[model samples]
Target: MTAQNLLVELFVEELPPKALKKLGDAFASVLADQLKAQGLAPDEAVVTAYASPRRLAAHVTGVLARAEDKAVSQKLMPVSVGLDASGQPTSALLKRLGALGTDASAVAGLKRAPDGKAEALFYESVAPGAALAAGLQKALDEALAKLPIPKVMSYQLETDCELPGWTSVNFVRPAHGLVALHGSTVVPVKALGLASGNTTHGHRFEAAVSPVVLKDADSYAVTLQGDGAVIASFAERKAEIARQLAAAAAKVGGGCQPIEDDALLEEVTALVERPNVLICEFEAQFLGVPQECLILTMKANQKYFPLLDAAGKLTNKFLVVSNISPSDASAVIGGNERVVRPRLADAKFFFDQDRKKTLASRVEGLGKVVYHNKLGTQGERTERVRAIARAIGQQLGGDVLAKSADTAAQLAKTDLLTDMVGEFPELQGIMGGYYARHDGLTEDIAFAIEDHYKPRFAGDELPRNLTGVVVALADKLETLVGMFGIGNLPTGDKDPFALRRHALGIIRMLVERNLDVPLGSLLSTAIDDGFGDRFDADVQAQTHTSVATFLFERFAGTLQEQGFSAPQVSSIRFDTSVVLTDVPKRLQAVRTFAALPEAPALAAANKRIGNILKKSEGDVSATVNESALVEQAEKDLFAAMQTTVPAANAKFEAGDYTASLQALAALRAPVDAFFDGVMVNADDPALKANRLGLLKQLHDAMNRVADLSRLAT
Candidate 1:
């Protein structure tokens, strides 16, 4: 009946750095979940997870030694089948009772319950609770089975027998120890061919003791830290590293700060049990290389955090997260500097060698490199992109913009052949910019060539200049149109070409840049220019429509993410002629109009009008014959339209969408009255056509901004 907090730890070889945090979180959560499900832990129990380079552990509070017993009801066969005609126990009933550990003597106690119109016999019993040892073992097994291990390793375990042999075991890493403690008592459980104990090893080199003997669940972290010289909690270790990094950077005393990279910080944290931040520096001569190249080389190859000055320029000084804290830190600093010098040198060498050949000369090598087997070589892809860029630039500006965009697009992918990019593919566009500047190209062209790959991922910034925008648009459009033309559409979550991202990039560029170009025209140009004569005319048309639809769908999702409601977005009818840049204005107008008091009635009336037009057989025109409207309500509605339509049309034409939608609010009363009094399907064909024509006029005037029927609930 008593409750106690529990502690569990798995000691093994170093875990995968990238997967350590996930594994630790999953282990704690799954084990606690299993305990709560089994009634061994309270509903409000607190679970704390700890992970180090060599161990994964969890502490759970309010865990019971054994779960409480529970009453269970089990359904049996129908009463008619279980009993004879006289209501006496039959052989079947006796056999069933025997299987339940009871006999016919107890059959009279069975209760009959209605199950789906038939009476069925039910047997009730009290199920015994699971003991701590068995429950913990089951929880441990389930937790291990569900861990998100990136990869598993198979290894042979050491045999206790004198004979030279080994037992094979498969796990994320080889396990040497497991510790399970309930309060201060050890819980006997087995995993990975090892029995649970209260003993676990700590820091390989700095632990004051060989193996830490945990005293209790509450004292696990404190004991580990004091005796083992290890910060057991992953969060605590990361925080300590951050604190030390800040202090070390401050001690360097040049207004220098460590580069803020969460991924690098986490990886470095996962590599050390006790972090000790140390400042080190390479030769100042290495600063001649681009800071990106040097900083990347240090961070990627050496796992060092390069410092930055106040202006955000990389300094020669960097910080290393050392595992050991030695009194004399010179050795550690000297050793790290020596190790990083060669990495920086390699980066410098690549940069210097890549600048030797101009981007123009490297353009020829792209032909040898295949971009996609079906899409042709990178050389052909560049030309396609160039054509698209030139066309787009001309529409946005004059020949000057067009020429700059063309040059940028042509040289954009040439960096794919550079030595720096060959070593680090992530530096492709970056190195291209550097090479372009070195080749004596204008800043605009160089920047365009560098930033053509801008907005590569979600939330990334778009190109800064007009020329860059043109080239970036062209590059993304080429990929989307080319991929969609070949029938390689993204299905479900499998977007191999990242077409969804490319579509979103296009949408962002149009809407955020406020580009005046129609989305349909842009897609058409991309398809026609990129795939010139490669496909039949019909196929090109279909591809254009499909790609445009895809972009609009992505746009709708983005709008919703920006806090616009689904109904608001859906109300705007997206078509080929619809300019994407105008969508935000329309959505804002719809939102404003929907808030007006008269909106609901007008929306409903518009819905009715739309339904009538959809079902009508003949062409419905807005040319209403004035004499045919005989009803007083119809005459009043017509008079109101004559006054309201002109003002709304003027506002719409002036691009004042909100005012246009607001102008229709005055007609709400007239609209409701007409809908109430008028019969659209009149007995006389001419009268019916005239009434339909008046409604058609009303519909057109009300919906120039957006389809109001979509707002009707």
Candidate 2:
């Protein structure tokens, strides 16, 4: 089969900036996949995706003009039913053959095959290949149907003829043109009420020509760039924008660079076809406000990339990605600066107004705002958090730390009433910190208030200070306990309150900071002392169990994600007294122990011992009577424990878990011999009890760091 590269493009109005990249990729991949499925393109065909503000396109190499014919064998029916005893075709066989465009004369060519217990007749034939025109039409329809459109717009297209009727069309944007070319020949295909052609329009304002005519599949991008004044490839255009942003920032001197935000870069890439990076500036007075507020407003509201100095502080200058390049760029820069000045002024006004009333004065207003209907107002939640924070701080530090935590927690949610935070809700903790410093509060409290929401998402940094860690822990714990208490738990992916994030935050604090606090004890304090009169006694106990289970499940998943084997994580039993800091060490010890040569035998023996203990008639104690040991194997096992148990226990007590587990390697021989020679279920009751007790002691010693039986498999 002769093959040639293919090109397809859909030109439309400006697409949704965030969804353009995904839509473009989906369009190209789906089109190529459908072509491959229809045998019109080879499996190893190279697919290149091109996207701009007004276009989605793809170029696939090695696309055949028509798919190759394929040999196919299809099962017809049972041989006995298809043929009579006289060796002639039955009416049913004739009818089935007729449906396949065959007749009774073709019966002799059919082959018989056994399909299970019964023999069935099979028909073999060569299926004709699909033409590129039909294959591409199917691919185009499937690609358009599978696009991840954020929203669809329905528009009416006027009939080209004098029908005087409007045809309704639905698409992400209004499609103005489509181009499909197999090499240099135009492929006849249609989409969104438009016929495919060899030409496409681009650069709504700066096109070098009216219609960019593509000469071939290979020339589409170059031709579009030269004649249309547009960059067709999304990745190439984004790289160009980034390069220009860097150049523009460097031109402003002072070691300035555009703030690094890939999402902002992608959005800007989707909003422009030519991508002219221009440096714009606002008044220096606006820099008095926190850079987070200014940078956020510029990026979020205006899609501008703000420049930051060497110290990572926001400068008055910012970069804008304009769609058109003019001989004199001053007008565009001035227009953007004028448009952003009012936004920056609003942020400044909010900041100045919020500072007039200190965070302390705003604390009382939180009562009016409901946090959750079942969990009371933000005022009550703040009180609970303060109580929890004080308790955790006292345990971590002394009275001074506790007082600081309480003060920080008291003012943490006061930012909810701030004008700056009200305008930008994402700046809640951030604005609180600024206000705290302005109120003459200590830096410790200010940082604590600001960082109480630290580690909001995965890979985010933890709280910077110990005070912040304490408040963050308390705040997360209070939310977890309160939500679990009210039976508002996360189901599937619908975590409306971000309880999963809050749980992970608590885990990170305890483990990363090595807080040395028992997770159970913290939950107990939060439940018993923090939320006063909120949950009843029964509800409190149930909530503790539910929350603990949920946290342990999340912790286990986290350990697995960190590259620990499932059995290793499973061995470290998560319980009320399990300290989060100790889990990783224990898991490492389990991993080390699992690598020993005697590990498998010991693990298997430990598993057998567990099964034996579970099946024993009465309660089996860890205490073994040495005098009752009759068998030689049992006596040897008991002697081995006398020296090994104390040494292992000492290492365990000293926190040398790996050494502790390694000590048990000496007993593997004795354990194997005991299982081989000893009869655990003796006819004599006292003898049986002694053997069971002996096995119970061995199991306890082996599982101190982790349950060794989990490593058996």
Candidate 3:
């Protein structure tokens, strides 16, 4: 009945930096969740997670020492089997009672209840609740088993005789100690062959005390920070590091700031217990290399944040987050600077050596590099992209654009053969742009080489110029059409080739750029020209539809994330012939039209017409027969359509989709009247066919911008 806070800690060797945060979160949440499920912790209990390089811990408040006992009802065998016809206890009843720790004397206490079609006997009793110690042990076991460890290590425990022991244990790292406490009392739990205790070792070198003793669950963080020379909370440590980084950057002046990278910040936080940010500098000469090369080298190789000036240019100085703080920080700064010199030097070397060879010369080497076993070498893929780019460029512009796009696509992938790109694959297209300038190539070609891989991930910027756009479109299409042709479509969550990203990139280019090129035409060009004879004839024939569907699905998902409702997207997406560039205009028009007072009635009428047309046997004509229209409602609707259709069609042709859809709002009254008074399925076949034809014309006019029926619900 009494409640107390709980603390748990697992001390081990250094954990994987990238996985430490996830492991700590999982450990705390799972342990707390298990306690709540077992009734050992209330729903209002607060849980705090702590993670460092050497430990994973949690502090939970308002945990019950033992869960409350509860009454339970358990079903027993049928009454017929438990007792004879006369209602006397049978041997089976006695055996069942005995198994339940009772005897024949308790048989009379059993109750009979109807279960299904038969009467069944039931036993009722009180079940004892779980104690904190046993519950914590179970929770601990479950948490450890569920950790998202990147790799597991196996080690043996030492024995008293100092001989190698045979008790092997597997964990993310070798476990050395464990601490579990309820209030101030040590909980009797064991894990990884270690008993629970109140003391834990802290920072390897800077701890003010050898072992930090926790007084209570609430005091764990304070004690660790004061005596252990460590910040226990992962979030707190990251924040402290960020604060120090900002302060340090401010001290540098000139509006200089440390480069912002969340992942790098988290990784550094996981690598230290006590963070101390110090400034370090490299020679100004190293800045001659592309700042991307220098910054990446510092972050990836040294885990440092390169400082940037007001103009967003990387400076020679950088910030280092060290685990130790000393009275004088000069030695740490000097040592880090010394260590980073070779990394920057190596990047400079790669950059210098790479520029010696032109991208055009590197083209021959791509022939030897395999792109995919099924897709042939990079040389062949580049040729495909070049052909596609040229075709797209020709369609969008004249011979000038086509020539630029072809040249850019031909040289785009050649950077993969460069030393800089080989060492840093993230800089593939980036290095190509730099090398193009060094080779005295035109700016358009150089930019196209770099921007061809634009919008590589979500939120990334698209190609900056027309040549870049043409090449990027060509590059992505080549991948999508080729892969789809090979039957390598993405299945649920398993996109090994990142075809989903490629498709989204294509969609973004088409929709964002508002390119006039048709989706089907682009696919056809990429297949028939880019990958001629590379795939089976049947696969080639189906590639356009399959790839277009995949791209449209990605587009629909994008729209949903942008706050468009599913039905709104569905209305436009249902038409495969709908131009990708025109989708936004059409969706905007639909949204605008839906706000009109007539929208609801017109949508419902359209739905009715759609259902009637679907069930009809023969093809319905769009031309209405005025002579066959006997009802005034039908005649008025037909007259309205004739007048409205011309105006809507003109606006639609002028690309004023919003205006086009808004023009049809006048028909809502006549549409409602026609549906209310007219019987579309008449007794006479000619009259019925003519009425159906009238509705068909109305449906076509209403849906020019979007399928209005989708808004009915």
lDDT per residue (tens digit) for residues 312-407 in model 3 = 999999999999999999999999999999998999999999988888998988899999889999999999999999999999898999999999
- The weakest ten consecutive residues by lDDT in model 1 span 527-536
Tens digits of per-residue lDDT for model 1, 1-713: 99999999999999999899999999999999999999999989999999998999999999999999989888878999999999998888888889999998778888899999799999888999889999999999999999999999999987768897889999999999999999999999999989988899989989999788999989999999999999999999999999999999999888999999999999998999999999999899999998988888888988999999988999889999999989999999999999999888899999899888999998999899898888889999999999999999999998999999999999999999988988888887888999999999999988898888889999899988999999999999999989888899999979998999988888888888999998888887898887876767888988988988898899899889988899899999998888898999999999999999999988988999999999999779888999989999999999999999999999999999999999999999888899888888999999999999999999999889999999999
Q: Estimate each model's TM-score.
A: 0.98, 0.98, 0.96
Give candidate 3 regions above 4 Å deviation. 78-84, 88-96, 111-119, 159-164, 573-576
- lDDT rank order: 2, 1, 3
Candidate 2 segments whose C-alpha is farther than 4 A from its true place: 160-162
The candidate that achieves the highest lDDT relative to the unseen native structure: 2
Q: Candidate 3 has what TM-score?
A: 0.96
What is the descending TM-score order? 2, 1, 3
What are the lDDT figures for the candidates, one per model?
A: 0.92, 0.93, 0.91
Deviation in Å, model 3, residue 82 alpha carbon? 4.4
User: Which pairs in model 3 have colliding backbones?
Assistant: none
As a whole number from 0 to 100, the lDDT of residue 23 in candidate 1 is 95
